[model samples]
Target: MALATLGVVVPGIAAFYEFVVKGRKRLGYRVQMDTTATNVVETDDPGVFDQLREPLVDPTLVLLRIENNGQTHIDEDDYAVLHDKKAGVTITFPDRKVVGMVVTELSDDGMRSSFEDGGGLAVKGSRILLPKVPMNRGAHYKVLAALDTMNGKMDQYPPPKVACTIKGGVTGGKIQETRSRTGTPKRVIALIVFLVAIVVAQLVVFTQSNNGAPLDCASGHLNVTGSTAFAPIAREAAKSYQDLCPDATFGFDMRGSGEGLQFLDQAGRDGKADGQLTFSDGEKPDDMPGLLPRPIAFFLFTLVVNKDSGVADLTGDQIERIYQGKITNWRAVGGNDLAIRLISRNPGSGTRNAFQRRVLGGVREPGTNSDDCRNRDPGSPPGVVRCARDSTDAVLRTVESTPGAMGYSELGAATGRAGLTAIRIDGHPATVDEADHGAYPFWETEFGYTAGEPAANSLAASFLRYLTNQVGADIIRSYGDRPCAELANPQLCRPT
Candidate 1:
């Protein structure tokens, strides 16, 4: 009788353990932004919902999707071991500076909020594990790991950095794999193993801090330069393309478009133009000849003022007068009764050229940046627009700091800066929709030009091809430049 009872008990225990405790529970992860998806929040404010495509207003969060590819289920309590890491996302910039989310916005759908409220879609706490949620085999769960747009550190046409690690499993004595922790000794060992796992992950991260640092490739170095306007975009593209072709590396110089065209011309003269690539935020000059024009992205210049200016929209004609030193007071354009400070860029700025031609009726404005900004007559208060910054960064800072100050920038360069407001032109704001509908007029077409045409197998050609495709276009859009596809509306344009 005793022997029979032992046999029955042992078999029963083994069967129970096989089905309940040691079932396989492996997980795989993907970090993706659902570009096709948009989460719109409605409020009493009129027309806010209608203009969801205002570039910065879209609140699509980046999702860290966890898929249970195991044979067993994973309860929420078992999976809640997800915290203890930084915001669950890691963003490395072109300069290899790593920035983690300091604002712990770990939240989810139930904790929904808008971009205005910093209501991004991060999952809030391990609280979502309260009811012991189950992750069945082949099932998926998504948590908001990061917001689409983060302020401060990320400003002006930033690149996409999608490097992250998502680790999930049971904690404590519950061995997630097919290992048994049924005894006091085993449980103690399991706990030790857990601590070691945590240490190893941290060690791997710190041990190789310089593992993927951007390379200064001199061997197969691909030098690209031009347009400070497009320099930010080029920097990002260089990083991404390096990831694609590890053998091909890049150097980007943010000299103005004039320099870009000049460099290409020199390269052409030396018969080494095959080794160069250049980009610009404006059209190719007639003298900068022999360059194939491959439009990479669409960029726009927007009139902007300090947020305190109380001025919001400006017609083309009014903007023309302001830049031409005609209109000199805020009250002249329905704002405070302060002097209308005319801000201009240094001489030969491509932005200035475009503005002068399109809005200022091609007439170059008088006064050097210093000369115009000079103290005016006490009686007149303000007059000709003066004050110029050689760089866009300086321009943005100048505009934001000055009261009643107005200036212009490539839409991307101006978007994320604080204390600055991009005024609408003719009641239409710069947006993808406005660009598509042709309502927001006169956007500069960005071009990537090689000395001649790049060969099919050439590195420059490959990079240019990448830029003109759907994926490349998406990356460009991520940088705040309108992809050529929007203009290609019924037609998708690819590099020849």
Candidate 2:
């Protein structure tokens, strides 16, 4: 029995040695190195690794069939690939040392069998396999392999070391060339769009700035139109105001007072005029629209004659008779025997309205041959030796130069002229003090009109306010006109 047990043990030991050791010797393996197309390869003058050192590397998967060059069969389940870091790996070379081999695994049925490079159990009729590895262009890599048996026996073999240089940094070079050719057009388009955006933003800012101070008038012009009699006074006030507000501009035009009302109407419809001046003929005209009534000064319409004429005063009835052609000769009104030359404003003038209302009782019919003694009509009239002047200046000149002539003008123009004398009206002297106190009977107010609310309170409005103030009253008095108290507040002009 002892002899039989010894025989069984010996056979078992002998079988294990043959299958695990001798069988593994027949399987030979080696490693190969290749360079990628994109990177440069540099090596030290002296070798950096010995044949006995284990190769350290980053191994990429490859797809290839490894033919069984010896008589062995490789198993599929006996291997794995490992890395210093499991997910991905990097290999660093210090001082550009010469590289040995990059380690990788081999498999029997296209699957890795062990972590060692070129490791596999092979049969003479079978082959091992690997998957392809990808690399950067011009990059160099080293590779090696090893073999192992399941029973702990292992062997490593070094393949011939070879060197190769990559010709170009292929991927990086292509990217740089593409950028160089296409950059200018894109940059120009971007710059144009940026500039356009900047201009639009600046315009928006300018508009907002103007909107904040629309009424300041620091950079604008204002225009006033209407009553010729009021034109000089308004112009003087505007000039004085301009001295205080240098950035503001002002202008005026004298059409007749009726036309002034029409201009007010037009301003209401189209925003044309900034102000209007008209005489009060007892009531405001219902036909005029959008008028903003404000009293700026008082004008007394007095009959003026050449200083050489002997006439100094006329009763209301005498003046009516003269305008009606009842008293054509100057001798009738205590003047020279010369013919009484009449200078009158145009028919549409508010001055004409005021004259007719006060003296002729609104009678305006033209006399027949300066002999008709009746007030036939109040809208049309004739005078002997009529000088049809549209403005106060013309009326004054006609009265001053013509012998035995009489015409009406505001007190301002009637005074200080060498050749004209103002006549007394209804036993009351036509004086600025009388007009200011309302005792002179021809006091009236002026107005400015606008459409709805103005776009904003404007410089024109400021000027109007100034014209009503005390300083403005002094200016008015200087011009031979009464201050605006009677027109502004009749109560203020009541007798003391």
Candidate 3:
């Protein structure tokens, strides 16, 4: 009888440790500071109000910190409130009315837009409402609001209360008060607790594990198409995903981003959108109705030149002048005296769009005048010869073999090619860290677009989930791209 009891209780404890203790997702909050306006007014001091407005009555200010103090990410869908109840979280001040509010601080500057109007931030009577803001692990923001008495009485009221009423998904939906930290000690404590829990759990139970299999796996044939810049990542990720799910298969159509999106648009119209998807170096066109975009990563691009050119860095002005047909020779830009050859991509390429938007300052590149990338076409007035390539690999190859040739390619694709150098812009190297800090300018948010939202259990959705998860993030980072999941400013992943 005692053995039977131990068997059941031990398994229950192990299950609890696995799901509740180790893998739990939590959202925590803390009221760091609260003060009433009346407390600061002295006997003879003027009240806290402008002459143009009514004087504040028992007006108070609150500093509230909300964070994803969880082991996993909290996505926008995780917020239980949706449809009719649009606010994700609600803060109530009993007997008080909210006058104004502002976001005081954030873990990432990318979060700033979330607090603006139309982001679902609203004030009604005594309640402050917030939109369904997605937060990565340890991401946080602070809200500062001014509150006044609703009944015009100067009497003190009860403290404010936060109710995380919309609890849905795997996350611990409710936001509860937690201890405020001013430094890194909170991380230290969390680490120590995690270590202790792991040791104790191992000692108490011998549990069977699934050997690191994916929890979300769907089997189906999916068609993928997209930017040549992003094709390598898509192919590699698809192969790995197939390894895990034997029944799943993927077909690729390596076309430019615009072409892929066009295909997806037609697929939607034909009722075959569920099994088709495309990846782009940037956002798809607005005219492609019914397409849903999921951000993937921040991909960096670089200007590559043949080593014989001897040019290491070019300023933004020089680049613009080059594309503008003003600078024609390598010697004009501090390089060897070789005639410049410009290798460009077709207009349909998303890489070309990003290059024009980010590096060319919203200007279009001059039309291709050379078919072979070696000589200009008849009747084309030229100082430098220019041509277009259909794929990233072709661009790299062309730049490598032609002296004084210059072209742009995805950072990963340009890293180790022979006879070519990945030149920097304004002396800043193409790196994720540099791009995140505004030092590098040739980066764009990568996106995955579908005709419509795939069913939760469909292969299209599961493959996307895999690309954004930890395993996929590791793969993405290995190729010199920064996955959206790890961005401090997640908003950067959203196409502008």
Give the candidate number with the greatest lDDT: 3
What RMSD, rounded to one decimal, does every model reach?
Answer: 20.6, 44.6, 22.5
Q: What value does the lDDT take at residue 325 in candidate 2?
A: 76
State the displacement of the C-alpha of residue 443, model 2, in Å, after optimal TM-score superposition. 3.6
Q: Is candidate 2 or candidate 3 better by lDDT?
A: 3
Model 2: per-residue lDDT, tens digit, 1-496?
9999999999998766655533421212222221211113454441221111332232111111122222233222211223111111122221122221222223332333232222222111111222122222222122222111222222322222211111112211100100112222445434433443343334335446645332333335776766777777777877776665677786666677777666666766775554333332223477654554555555566778887778887787788888777887878778888777777887767777777765677688452332121222344555465545778888888778777778887777677888998888767787656655555655444444443444344665666656665345556666666545534455433322
Ranking of all candidate structures by their TM-score, best first: 3, 1, 2
Off by over 4 Å in 3: 1-213
Model 1 agreement with the true structure over 1-496: per-residue lDDT tens digits: 9999999999999865654554445544454332211223555663322232222232222334445555566644454334322132233223222111122222233222222221122223211111122456666544332123333323332333433222232321232112222323445434433443343344335435545432232226788977777777778776777774578788777667777878888888889886688886666778767777787777777888987778999898888777777788778899888677667766656776766765676788776435335345445534554677776777788888887788877888898888988988889998766755768764667778888877776778777767766235556776666667556452322332
Which whole-number lDDT from 0 to 100 does residue 321 have in model 2?
85
Considering every candidate listed, which one attains the maximal TM-score? 3
At residue 314, give the lDDT of candidate 2.
Answer: 79
In model 3, the clashing pairs are: none
Ranking by lDDT: 3, 1, 2
In angstroms, the error of model 3 at 306 is: 0.8
Considering summed lDDT, which 10 consecutive residues are worst modelled in model 1? Answer: 95-104
**lDDT by residue for model 3 over 1-496, one digit each (tens)?**
9999999999999877655654456678888766664534455655433221355556666668898876667866777764434468888989888766666568988777766544567777789897777788899997776776887775567778987742443433456678977633446434433443343233223222233345576888999998999898889999899887777899999788989999999889899887898998898888987899999898899999999998999999999999888888889988998888999999989999999999999999988889988888999985678899999999999999888899999999898888898888999999888888888899999899988888999999998888886356656776789788567677888866
